[model samples]
Target: MLLFQKLYSRIYKYSKMLFLLQIIVIVLTFISLDHEAIAELPYTSVVLPVHKHTDASKPLYSAEVMTSFIDWQYMRENFLIDIDATIIWHDCSLLWNKNQGDCPTNSCNYPVTCEEYPCTDIRTSSSYKNRYCPPKTNWSTLPVWGLCTCPVNVVNPVTVSCVQVSLNYDNFRFNESNGRNVYTGWDDVYPHAACAPSSSLQSFPANVTGVLALSSSPYALAGYLHKPLKRVLGLCLPSTLSTPGVLFYGSTPYYLLPHSDVDVRSYLSYTPLIKHQNSFGYFIGVNSIVIKKRAVNIPTNATTKISTTEPYTILRTDIYNPVVRRFLKVTKRIPPAKPFPPFGVCFSTSTKGTQVGLRVPDIEFSFPDGKQWTTSTANSIKQVTKDVACLALVDGGAASEPAIIIGTFQMEDNFLVLDLEKSAFGFSSSLLRKKTSCSNFNLTLVNSYV
Candidate 1:
């Protein structure tokens, strides 16, 4: 019996040791696999938030650079967008074929067709040359001070000052959510896009494309960055919590910023874009502003027209200043802290017995499409100094003007998607866990794929 007991004790001890060994092997294997898995997925993007202690930082400038790749790569072929014009020539006998009655070679019997004096269409089927230079006889038509010539030969000239030729055109094509191509739908022909970065802005601007004339949204730069392979451009903006902002073009947005499981596409609440004359950027309607459960009245004429009873705010408008002024007057009940420079209304919890952020009212954004989003105090309020927090909003211009700009600060902690294919703007609340920085944003990608 004693021998049996000894044998049983030895076997039990060995079994316990084996179990622990297995657990150790499993843990190490998982650790190895986790890193290997990340390595295999080379294109997952990790972004950090951009932040400032003094004032709101410029994220648009950064975004502008990233999107320019589209112009540099894809928009090169879209240089010349066609418009309406005609091969018009007035008779001056400037050349031989234009010789009406003044040709040394009587072989030139071209008709003299001038629209102002109703020339006979009897020669309509002919090369009608109006005095290429108004005839010395028609001095009263003296406005013909300069010489005229069609640089290119026109074989078929109609008797009119203008002609209709529908080809590539110069117009802003804002992409709607449907990914519809505004250009001609046959055989995939898009308008040519051109911009001259080197040319100084001036009269007789070398860049006739008008694209290079002025920098505008989705046009000058942001509109250009479509991935050759992905055919998509993605923007990962840092949340107020300090996540990093990333502009993804020609690269995959494999992982959402600050988290891996959260897919930006899933959280989207879409608002169809308003087809305003301005196609420089995505335009949407703003209904009203609600603060702490109260509807804050938007000043009259906040938008060009009333989208609803509330003045609408569009994306990237310079309306921050006006809305802010009203915000200051309404939030007087909250104990005021020392105002920060440029940004006036501030709140502080570090006033001797107070917190660094206290008495700050929550800000809510209500849109014309019934989409409402509220900002956490972290987004609405920002730290300026060690002991001071100020309203992150900027105050601009007189309230008399319609100003309802939804700036980047207001967009903090939001996953904003600017889908050029759809010609629409969409965003959703970002689940933020921490403050991130762009200083060490390392992008991992497969060497085979850019």
Candidate 2:
């Protein structure tokens, strides 16, 4: 047993000596390696001097390079070289402890979690797979959104101006037709036809002496008369006869009444052969008439009777007298004016017997010479001869046959006042009644001289 003990002690002592030898050797080797590494490093001092920079002018080592060097040194000395030593050098500063949680071992170390770092969970954190880094701050510096939404295309707007005139013939015709017939000596003509202008006959031929009336009525008294006159002149007279002369009582012979604002009142009468269409035929016989102005009220103070004077002009002379004269000259006395052998008067009753009543066509008269007047300019009368000289030439005479004057006539005293209120408020028939009632008039004169 003693021998065994002695042997164990020797072995223990030998082991201790060997351990000391190993420690000395390790220290020497470490010193030698460190010295060699230092010697092997390029001389920053020499490089500085070559570049003509002093040690103070040389750039210092960067923190990243220093940290990398220190980490490599620690890993080599503590882990790779010392195989038996369990001590490990860990860079806790490099590891993220807040994101990775506590280190797995006491010797293990981790980095801290920065607020900018995108950590999934500190308790059970994960490594960044995409290596994405969050922005250091919020994006409050950006400009406002949605500022450019309007389209850049489309068009714009523009302006313009336009003038017009209207006339009423009913009033004009009525007024003219109702004028006094001084030559005929009829205060009002018989059958009242002489008192009204015939719509069928227009102008009397130039040679015949007769009273001519001008109307402002729209029924076209002159135009109506003209239509039949065209036929009559063609049938009854030679083509060589000159166009008939025209006379106007208040204005120039050619002056036609304007239709606007004229008062119209008249009635119509005719035989059965005179339809509305053929009614105009009735105006043919008396185209040539001396249009004269007769004083409505004869003044006792006047030295001379108001003779033909200003504002009264003869428009045309009657051609019917010459035709009759020619016929009488040939036959020794006037022949009947109708139903000649060649063309018998073909009377049509289809629209016949339609009669229209009307007032005299309105006349504008010159205020009687040297006399004061209270009425409107339209109502004043000037002498017919002074106003128009053409009246002096016409030859007045008796009718060849007892001529039947066909025209509309109205009551000399009654004037139509259009009751607009009645027109608007009353029944439609009331208006029709007024229209019909105002359309015609009739008067009879015996042995009336033309």
Candidate 3:
């Protein structure tokens, strides 16, 4: 740890050496490094907002979004991200806890902008067990004053031990590029799960890739520390065709709703989250499908599960085409036109049906616990070519069972939450409330008392 601090100090002092020598030597090199990136360290304070087709204000989600490129092609189609985590620490002092120094308190900056981890609720919970970080002492002699951080190797419940922790992330996609590598020295406490770098994570062949092990789970950081909060993760998919979306840790979108101040219970729709393989994906049970408020005839054994295909549900492009054909047969809504060359059940935009091509009706999916998400036609029917618009569903390869993956396109303008504590998934199928500002979603303020 002392060596780690010295590296930062030297980098700070000889900042110019970085550009002049063009040598990129990271203290904690985690990702595939690019020589061009040797000029500067990855910036964590810079909040990145994913734009909707290049629009500025209308972004998908805004955060200290770490854009790390990969060498895969799983999520390239829908622009979906898979398996990420937010590492937060209480008491910036953790950076200096292992190794004390004579540097200025603020000079030992940890790159990312972080606030003290609130312990109000944890200290009060039975989980607290009187195991709290000692009260702050004025170590004025050292760079940082008395600070608390998660123990590097010791296993203390995050809420009680006051250690740095990671958040839960539940999307699955692969990036196949040589992007930037971001690292945080404060987070050396992970369980060190081994994950192969640069692998293609496609959403097909349901049983091809089993779930990731908890140890190797990148988002498992939440379970290590966010136990008191149940390790819940809330996400509101992009509301518009071009607008980006927002994701939250420790809280669900329903609890953060504009009108949820009173009865938050009424806003929750839950589905049992069955862990498939290990942590690879959350396998859900789809009871039935209803189109235009009418039930579609599904074979008895034809199973459906919601996988994290992101932007749109995923199935191999070939498999998706066949399902689209079956859906057309069941709905009898419109006749299929020429096949969309690349993939998908495409048709001419000029249909006898109303405004656009083969006007599709509302598709509703039933889940366990009476939870259901009805797709809105506007986002469901996608316009691909000048004269063609296909269903927004993603196309992947063939898997053993029929693929009925619930995608982000179907989840647009909706608030979804992954409640790790309860092992359930909660969501609001309604439109994203334009007035709701996640400012209150601040974890420090909410957990201040603990």
TM-score against truth, every candidate: 0.46, 0.12, 0.48
Q: What ranges in model 3 sit over 4 Å off?
A: 1-80, 83-219, 224-228, 239-243, 252-265, 293-310, 315-326, 329-337, 341-343, 350-359, 394-402, 430-450
Lowest lDDT block of 10, candidate 3: 173-182
Question: Which of candidates 2 and 3 reaches a greater lDDT?
Answer: 3
Candidate no. 2 TM-score: 0.12
**Candidate 3's residue-wise lDDT over 1-450, tens digit each?**
999999999988798876655544452242344433532322211111222321321122222222112332111122223332112221112134235454343323232111223222222333223224443212112235543322211112111133322111122211111111111211112222111111222221211221222221332434443222235655554544443444444432233334445333355678887654422345566665666555544444444554333446665444455456656775465555566633356656765654464556666667755667766665577666666776666565656344555654566556566666687777666553334433322122111111
Give lDDT tens digits, candidate 1, residues 100-212. Answer: 35435321222222331222221232322232322212211212333221121111111212211111112222211111011121111122222122221121112221212
RMSD values for the candidates in order, in angstroms, are 24.0, 58.2, 20.8
Residue 339 accuracy (lDDT) in model 2: 35
Better by TM-score, candidate 2 or 1? 1
Please give the lDDT score at residue 331 for candidate 1. 71
Better of 1 and 2 by lDDT: 1
The 0-to-1 C-alpha lDDT of every candidate, in the order given, reads 0.38, 0.20, 0.40
